[model samples]
Target: MNNNTQTRTYAYVAAVLYAAIIGLSFLFVKMTVSVAHPIDVLAHRFALSLLVVSIPVIFGWIKIKLTLRDLWRIIPLGLLSPVLFFAFQAFGLVSSNSSEAGIIQAMAPVFTLVLASIFLKERTSIMQKLFLLLSVAGVVFIFLMKGSGMSAGNFKGIALLLLSTVCFAGYGVLARPLAQKYKPMELTWVTLMVGFVVFNAASLIRHVSNGTMMDYVKPLGDASYLGALAYLAILSTMFSTLLASYALTHLEASKMSVFSNLSTLISIAGGAWILHEPVHGYHFIGALLIIAGVLGTNMSGRKRGLVIPDKA
Candidate 1:
């Protein structure tokens, strides 16, 4: 086959793989968080992923050729994405039901688009902007209409989730060019390591302050907890990261954002099966509208200013 045909084929494969990774995400999240605290789950998840990738570092399969200049970019990507993003997202998952959290997270692409416009100077079509707006409205609708057990106590969780989306969105936009420069595998290797340092340091602080690193370790005795942790660290973090990087190589940043719409569906199914969370009809409707908005935004491509690469 010609080069263009080969590239398009890889893009299609990447899209499917990206969707699968997202679909499986909530299941792993639910499994991991069940026995451990959210922070612990995130901390160990990154730590394990770091360990898994170390083989590449050791064998020179991947090179960490980062300069002081690259540090500026790498630091923010690490901080916003795997560090703050996972921290908040995990906290949000713990505080709220998965169903609600899933619905809320469906707005990530919309938020990403907004951040892309501000940070990356990415252009969005007018219709793309409108659909993105509509997607946000759908999220607000979920918050107001369906209810999220939103007390002052859980308000922080909701806010955190929203903030995490912004961080992730910004990362997506900024990382695109980086993805072009470094192969996704190489990029993930570096970024995941950066994230690991930040998260493990934070984990260290928390553990020391509490005088209780033992508590986090104790959960490893539980079979399910360990299994869940393995799934998340290996499958979700390592494998998914690799798959997503592959997809980003193949697809346009704007086009890839559309795959994030699948997360709500996956989360809903996962919530129902794993968390036993109820899925209200309104939730389904909201999800549908959100997906529609994502597709519309992509197809219209009219506004061209607000594109953020969506995540797996």
Candidate 2:
């Protein structure tokens, strides 16, 4: 295959994998936070992720050449994602249900599209914009049909989650240019390292102040907790971020953001099969809309003969 074709293939695969990882991540996050504080869980997740990614670099299996200027530029990108994005999300979930959070997250594509158009000069067709809205509407439809009651207290959570979406959308837009300059592994490693330092420091201060420094090790005793943490650290954080970074290298930020909607369908199916959550009529309807929107948004690429170069 030609270089552009190969790049597109990789981008599609990365998008799919990133969506799947994120879809199932909710389960692991629930299991983790049940036993540990959210910040502590996030600290451990990134700390371990840093070690996992570092092995290859330490052993010279993956070589990365980056200058001080490059590192400075990349730091803000990391701050946008694993730091600010996750902090908002973690705190947001404290007050909001998964359904509500998922609905708000569906708006990320819109934020991403606007940011891309302004910063990257990327443009989308009217049809693509409609399909993006359709995908978000599908999520809202499912939650509304489920009759999930909301309280005034949830407004705080909703606002925080929306902020998280904006952060992630910004990350997507910012990462695109950097992707052209850095390897995916290099970018992922740096982001994970930044998260590791920030979260661990925050977690340390919280524990020490609360006199829970010794209690911090208590969660490590549970095998189930360890298993959940492992998944979050490996598949959800490291692997998914790597895939997203790689995909952003080949896909427009708007396109990559839409793929996040697929996670709603995956989450629905996963809940039914794994969590034994009941499947409802609204679930099927919402899934169909999400699938249709995803296809409609992506179909434009084929008609327009969209191709990304292998190199900047």
Listed in order, each prediction's TM-score against the native is 0.84, 0.94
Per-residue alpha-carbon lDDT of candidate 1 for residues 105-185, written as tens digits (9 for 90 to 100) = 666777666666676667877777788677656656665776556698688877877776666666677666666666676
RMSD of each: 3.7, 1.9
Q: Per-model C-alpha lDDT, please?
A: 0.69, 0.84
Best by lDDT: 2
**lDDT per residue as tens, model 2, 217-295:** 7888999989989998999999999999999988888899998888877766776676566679988898788878888
Q: After superposing candidate 1 on the true structure, give the runs of residues whose Cα lies further than 4 Å from its correct spot.
A: 5-9, 12-16, 60-72, 134-145, 250-252, 302-312
Against the correct fold, how does model 2 do in TM-score? 0.94
10 residues in a row with least lDDT, candidate 2: 301-310
lDDT of 2: 0.84
Instruction: Report the Cα lDDT for residue 97, model 1.
Output: 62
